[model samples]
Target: MCGIVGYIGKREIKRQLIEGLRELEYRGYDSAGIAVMQNGKIQSFKAVGKLSNLDEKTKNFETEGPGVGIGHTRWATHGKPTELNAHPHMGEYSYVVHNGIIENYREIKAMLEADGVTFLSQTDTEVIVHLFEKEIERHSDLFSAFKATIDQLDGAYAVLLITQKAPDTIFFARKGSPMIIGRNRQGEVFFASSDAPLIGEAEEVAYMEDGTIGYATPDLIHSEPDALQFVSLSGDKLTAQKGGYRFFMEKEIYEQYQVMGDTMIGRVLDDDIVFEELGKTFLEGISRIKLCACGTSYHAALTSSYLFERQAKMPVNVEIASEFRYKEPLLTSDTLFIVISQSGETADTLEALKMAKKAGLKTLAICNVDNSSIVRLADATILTRAGIEKGVASTKAFATQVMVLWMLSIFFAKKRATLDNHTVKEELRFMSYVPKVLQKALDVHEKCKRLSKRYLHGHGFFFIGRDIFFPLALEGALKLKEISYLHAEGYPAGEMKHGPIALADAELFTIALMPKTLLYEKTKSNVEELSARDSTILSISPEMFELADDFILTHPHKHPMLEFFEMMVVEQLLAMEISIRLGNDVDMPRNLAKSVTVE
Candidate 1:
């Protein structure tokens, strides 16, 4: 996914835009650019590589203000990440920055080229600017041009545009892909692809709703009636000043405390976890539920499958998005589809969602980014409030999604009379206290750092667990392989004899996710199976800590329904620590992009 940021104020637009881009560096981009409308003319600068290239290029420009601006960090999908293909695309008449793939833009581009529009770049973003130039000739107002342009669009997109005619205004629209509006101390309004760019610059934040358009200014804004009403805000003074952390990822990893707080913020009231009004019809309408996801989200859904079946007495199927769409799946109108994606722009997941909708099934999406394609297409949505997961290896987002799934499961289970009221009350209370438990793991970070070398050279390591922890094993292996250069396998502890046991040897290091639950002692005994293979075992549990090569402990009061997510978090943190220790660029791993946008 690409990143977009905009500012309309007297403050130096170039400085603010670049500063914001630095904050959002984790979104993963190949090229970066910015455009400011000064003196009724657009001045633009873009670089093919890192944002630093733009920094070097812009060194000659004075930071003058009294202008409107828009900037972009691009992840190439339609074209190579070259200078000619970078964003902040100008169409002789307009400058635009966009986030999602425009599914049918090639066709639209061919039509635009026929109009004598000299194309400068090979990008779907360029097509929109060209189309808008034509649309603007007919309707000059930014709002009207944006409304008409959106009507002609074919796929997921969040667009922020500025033109010579309306240089003071930014026509921001979202059909899909996330875009948010924020307000600053001077009542200045800011818009970005995500909140990371606006966090310390703007205080009051409102996630833009789907099918909504907004006209923004330093001190003015108007949006669709359904959007969040304008609110005033100021940045956190402490974070605004560098906290001496070496990297944003490091600062963010440490910010887990606030992320946990924000997730539970106001959403819990009087010991009850009401999910700030997610329409329950998403849960109630599921005569049957199919959870579709990719990567870490897939593992989270796998865990949810066990929870739904056990706690809600509901039959749930978890399918990887890439495999789900092509495989012959038995479908029915009564089926409910649930999609989980951190960015909500994952191409395969988006396509799978479309297929499910074509089958006439009602759909619900659980996503961290509001206004993403999955969110727009879904009949309903429950948003996880973990703001801007910059780390390519997801930590908080995965945990929060599982937390939401757990809550949703109990909510529906109680609605169907499958769970008792006492059970619901206890899980809610337990989830609220998990932040303190998570903080305990930070004390063990150094141990995890020391534990990396054993896995770095590891020919193969095994992750073994049963029941809910089975998915935890799968997720742990995935995180390790994705961010770290290691060979790993995840298997149900009961399936060791089927084949995995033969691969086990003294050099093999096995990590078992043990918890104090119905399967506690059984899971502990399974550890012996690995130990018998002369494997060095590492166990993470709250129930028992036996003498092994390694052990990580959780607090004593583990929440029955919520423990799965906490352990998943532990493994994710461990995996990242190991990945960083191996000299891998933990945020951007090799042969992989954050979102598999190109099928």
Candidate 2:
């Protein structure tokens, strides 16, 4: 994924474009560039690093007239990360900045080369500008020529173009990727890949629907009908400023306490859990439950399997969504399929939900986005209410998903009479106190910062736990590898001797989750086995302080679910602090997109 920002106004375009690109660099930061019109001529500048590189290169440019420009921060899809491959590609008539991939660029490049059109860079974006040049020569109107150029292209794209003939106008089109047009009070129009760049710059913003084309000038804008309607930029999104924190991940890590409160607002009452989204007859004749997801969502589902099976006494099956569709599953009318996704647009999970519906099985979706495709397609839906998760490595979404799964498990347990009235009351009491325990966990930031420094030079890392916490260990390893770019593995405590024990050595650092539950002794024994092999140990526990080489002390809790939730917060902070210390981008990891819409 790449980031694109454009502006058409009377202010200095270079300053605004550079400032907006700084806010949008999380989408991509391989390179940065911008193109502005000055004195009836188009000028372009690009650099082969972060946005800071482009800012330095354009510090001396004169951008004082009725300036209009477009900028980009590329993730490098078709070419290597070089200055020549950066965006704002120039042609005979226009300069363009594009976001998505063009699948048919090779064919168009061959045709353009045969017609004596010289290419300057190795990017698919260059073909778009040159193709528009050819179309403009044939058509008289600029809008007609832009539409004709879009008709010839294949694949997902959010393109922004500015021509010498129409320097005051910014033309754009969107198919699959995201783009939002924002309007300021001064009749200035801004466009970007997301609302992050437009948060403080504009008060009103509109999203471009699929297969839409439009243009914006200082005075007017016209496009497909109803495509120009605007909404307030501040729409209860979780993109607030980092209140005294150094990074967004740090602020989000501490926000886990408030997120638990938000997720349980009206659902968790004094005694029973009420999910009004699913009716009383929604669970009728559901003999078995099938959970499908991918990556971090799949780990959440794995944690759900333990809850549904033990508490609700339900037969639960968890499968990776990408692998679930390939196998011919034996489905029945009694099978209740459940899909989990934060974005609600994960391609594999959406496809899996479609297949389940086609087999005559009832479907339910748990997602963060309310109007996403998966939420609309399912028979019933439960919104996570986690708000917008900006970081590529998920933090709040995972916590909210676990809370929802607990509510679902308790509801099923009460319905089946597996948990009595007194047990339900006790569980609810423990759940209510989770917010306080999470606050105590956030206070351990300095201790985790100290512990994380020791493992920066570790050759490899291992995480091991038992029962419900086994999935939490998997999530910790996933977060570390996603942001820190380190090699890590998570396994069940008993399975360490089966295969992973061979890799334990002085070079390996193992983090053990011993939460003092029923399987505490078994997990503690696994830690001893690693210690025998000369592996460094960091034992995370409430009371077992001297059992390992290092200790991350947590507050003691008798409830297993509360202890697991507390440990999840600690692991999130651990991964973030380690990545921060190692000088890696914790919020936006390399080569990872927040939403996997393209599969």
Candidate 3:
């Protein structure tokens, strides 16, 4: 995903455009550019690699006059992340910044080239601007031309256009990609890929729905009222201050306690779990659960299998969404296919949900975005309410998804009469204190940081656990390798001797999940095998301190099912701290994008 911003207001927008680009950089930072219509022509400046490069190019540029402008920070898709392929690509009359692909770009490009229209860059976005230029020639009105242009394009997109013919207006349209429009009391209007840039600047924001077209000017923004649903965003979230934390990742890691609490609110009542959107009848007659997801969401699904099997006494199957369809799963009336995604627009997950729906099986979605594609496709939906997860390595979203799964498991247990009222109350009470218990984990932040430093320079890392904790170990390994660029592997503690133990040595670091349970001795024996090879041991348990080279004590969970929640937070912090110590880009890791929209 790329970040795009547009400003059409009473004030000069050069500085605002730069500031907005910086705020939205988490979406992408491969290249940055800005365009303003000046003297009936487009004034465009672009550079490759980060907003800083564009800032350097515009250092001596003038912004004395008020102007409507649009800017982009790109995560390249159709072309390389070079200056030639940056956004704000111009045509005869328009300069445009675009997010999302044009599936038929080649067909459109070929038709335009046959007409002798010159193309500037190797981007599908350039094709869009040229098509818009052609549309204006016949339509004669900017709004008509913009709408006509969007009608011809296929695939997902959020487009912002500024043209010489309409120098004072900024026009935009979206289909299957996120876009927001905001307006202030002074009549200034702002547009961004997300609400990050509009937080403090605009008084009210309207999240644009798919297939909507709008335009903004210094005095007003014009669009169909029903196409958007406005929401109030806090100004405090827009501030650049990191709340005294070294990085946004660090700040977000700590925000988990609060956000996870938010996810639980109104949903978990006294001694009961409730999803207002789904009634008790929703889970009735469900013989099996098929969970489809990818990456972090898939690990959450893996953990859900344990909860559903043990607590709900139901059979649960987890599949990577990308492979689920290929396997040609046998779907029946009693099967409930659940799709989990933070963005809900994840392509493979969406496709898997579609396949399940086509087979006449019931579908459910666990997602953060209420209006996302997967939510729209599902028969029932549960919102994570984790808020916007900006960091590439997800923290709050994962915590909230697991929490929802546990609650769902309890709900199923109740329906099947497998869980007694006493057990339900105990689990509910445990869920209620999750936020406080997670905060207690943060109390040992310095210990995780210290442990990070000691193991930051290790040659490799090993993460091993059992049952529900096994998936958590996979998640921990993922966080470390993704953020820190470390070579890490995760395995079931019992399976370590099958093959992974051969890789153990003093040069490696082992993080063992040895929670005090029936299998604690087996996990401890796995740690002993690692220690025999002189590997440094990092234990994540209330006990097992004697077996660890460095141990971060986990606050005891009255219910064993809740232990993984605290373990996940500690792993997230350790990954962040290690990445920081290595001088790595903790938020936007190398060659990684936050949302994987493309296949």
Quantify all predictions' global Cα lDDT against the true fold: 0.76, 0.85, 0.82
Candidate 1 lDDT, tens digit per residue, 509-537? 88888878748878777787778777888
Look at candidate 2 and tell me the lDDT of residue 530. Answer: 87
**Residue-level error in angstroms, candidate 1, position 261:** 2.9
Q: Write the per-residue lDDT of candidate 2 for residues 1-599, one digit (tens) a residue.
A: 47899998888999889988887754435688999986568989999877778878988886776868999988655665788889999998689999766767889999999999999998888999999999988998999999999999986789999999886899999986678899988888999987777887888988898888988888988877455778887732235244346677777778777667656755676898877688889889997899999999999999999999988999999999999989988888898899999999999999999999999999999888655799889998887766557788998889989889988999889988899999988888888888788888887789889888888986888988999989999999999999999998888988999988999888898989989865888888888988999988988898764648888888888898888988898888899889999999888899999999875
**TM-score, cand. 3 vs. native:** 0.63
Candidate 2 CA-lDDT value? 0.85
Model 2 stretches with alpha carbons more than 4 Å out: 1-240
Q: Work out the TM-score per prediction.
A: 0.62, 0.62, 0.63
Residue-level error in angstroms, candidate 3, position 545: 3.1
Off by more than 4 A, model 1? 1-250, 280-285, 543-547
